[model samples]
Target: MAEWEDGFWSSKDGLRLHYRDYPAKAGSTRPPIICLPGLTRNARDFAPLADRLAGDWRLIVVELRGRGDSERAKDPLSYVPVTYLEDVTALIAEAGLDRFVLFGTSLGGILSMLISATMPGRVAGLLLNDIGPAIDPAGLVRIRGYVGRGGSYPTWLHAARSLAEVHAVAYPDYTLDDWLGMAKRLYRLTPAGRIVADYDSAIAEPFKVPGNESAGDLWPLAEALKPIPALLVRGGLSDIVSAGTADRMQAELPLLERVDLPRIGHAPTLFEPECEAAIDRLLARVGRAG
Candidate 1:
């Protein structure tokens, strides 16, 4: 693991979001890469990649609000992507990075697309990991199922098992310990010794307010990001990003480079050799494509 250190980012609402610092090699002038974790995930998700990328670029992994060490919002409604988008912009400025690259996964991608469109100049390039404009209702529901639910498991091991039971199909490469680590990262130990979900569950409640309605029409967001150097890394077996959507994205934005990772779904964890290779290729392209 990278030498992890704590970071705090104050949102406009006065909420201080938590983050981890992964410093790159000395004298490394590579443009910073801001990593955005998936729903209910934290900075730990990027440790594997952050360690590898240390020689090339600095990685700022954010915990977002209500996830990791970040404080939970009293109002769950404050947990939506809009809140996160604002937090991201604040962190970028706080980091003194007027512009940087974005490596966004799942929810992070949604936030990235929003930011790239809203604050185009701040984004040098975008790395979308295993997500796209079109998402399946089934995948969204499955993700929502666990977003803020703190299940009654006596031990963390049980929670890990619960995750394995639910997500094993999507992440076959993860061992039980890996699943346990994932569970641990996603949940914090409460004073009562029970697992309370780390993220603000209320952030996801809006999606449930209306049946079958997406958080918003993200396609317009994608379309608005025209001519920006972008790489959409899709998993071949991903149910969330249908093949048609990927094709449509390519058609709409010819500059968007699409790479499909075989034997993966929803998202690639970015720990595998194949995934790493794809990212390396993207990095080279990003540096030159600009």
Candidate 2:
């Protein structure tokens, strides 16, 4: 049940944003699920999940700026989540979609929550893969180290191998090719011909700068999805979104249902039968209303 899914458009900044969609190919029944990938991820990562769910709800995955086949921004500051929301709004309009479901993971989840708050009317429902309002500082530091690292990897194999270790909690079984595909989507071949990461290197500017002392809070955004049907899926061992926070989220918004996958961390890849079935239930619950 892991397999198929494209909608490609140029952003206002002139970077091509690659979106892979299942569309309403034959079933003209419902709007599609807009798949928002994680940081350093591309649309292709959703291929397996998209193909598996095509028989039910349609799936559309977007390659965010500086990731996947999408072009990197000239202004590194543009890589922020706020910029991402505007870009997604553009894509939604370009797709000719008035309203649709949002399936977001990690960074994508953050954007989904924000968009749900800013453009509630546009999102039919919000599917959060493995993220929440409170993020673990330890995990943020880990991510910062890699995203902020410099220099080219000797080869894709080396890069992939390194990720498998660093991401062992989230991607324990990822194959060499899986890692390679990941590397491809997150980086592009530089003009000098070497494979540099798919970002303006400068994109990490704000993130690297000295901390603006404020406890980050996304509950406002998460709570905004309250009226709209929503589902939160978390990995059991995830450092990013712990069970404690997920529980608190459920309590705050009783309407927002929650589930946790065992033995995974950061995010679940969403290819397992249990995970798939759980998602289908959530989508059906929301999609059936419209």
Candidate 3:
């Protein structure tokens, strides 16, 4: 098992945030890789990937406020992406990270772009998993349908079944065992012994406001990635980042390395063999650039 230390830091507004700090191997000079998960996900989502890459390069897997061991925000409305950017900015300063690679999935990918745009030269490389500047409306509608709703399951099996019902389209090859493992990552045991979604349901409140569904004019943000070594992993079955959008992203950012996972859905687990290889290639390019 890859070992990591549980780390905590305070957000600018005083919310206690958490992350898993996996140190690099002794004497390694590789830039640390900072990971950010999807909107409803937490640091646990990166455990498998961390297990594979931890010692070669430092890994910082963050849990945004209201998710994982992080303190819930007093005001649910604070769950917006800009607020998340503020929290991550504080973390960068707290960890004293001068330059690093960004690995973001969905919402995390958006954050990575924002960080690179704002910080300019600090980001060494980027790995955007299953997201782009243009998000499909169908995907947005599907996500909104479940984001804030709450549910409790009597057992892990039940929870897995529930998720399989909703997401099987995205992971058609997932076995019962696979679903079970995913359930553990996505839900947590309650004091009452019931299994429930790990995040605060109120994180979904912002989606309720009209016109917030679209992320609005992100093409300019994509420009920030043009000069850096970047990788885009797109699931062929993904409803979020369509083929058209991915093509445009590559056309605009000529240096991007694009990998299409035909069997996957909205996001690639990064555990996939193809994803692992692509990431290694991107990091090598970063190493050469440095």
lDDT of 3: 0.93
Give the better candidate number (1 or 2) by lDDT.
1
TM-score of 2: 0.85
**Candidate 2 lDDT by residue in tens digits, 236-266:** 8787888789898888876677888877787
Give the deviation of candidate 3 from the true structure as CA RMSD. 0.9
TM-score, each model? 0.89, 0.85, 0.98
- On TM-score, the stronger of 2 and 3 is 3
Give the candidates in order of TM-score, highest first: 3, 1, 2
Off by over 4 Å in 2: 1-5, 150-157, 169-202, 211-215
- Candidate-wise lDDT, in order: 0.79, 0.76, 0.93
The deviation in Å at residue 258 for candidate 1 is 2.3
By TM-score, the best candidate is: 3
* Model 1 root mean square deviation, Cα atoms: 2.3
Taking the tens digit of each residue's C-alpha lDDT, what string does model 1 give over 206-227? 6666543465568888766676
Q: Any residue pairs clashing in model 1, and if so which?
A: none
Worst 10 residues of 1 by lDDT: 207-216
Cα lDDT for residue 235, candidate 2: 86
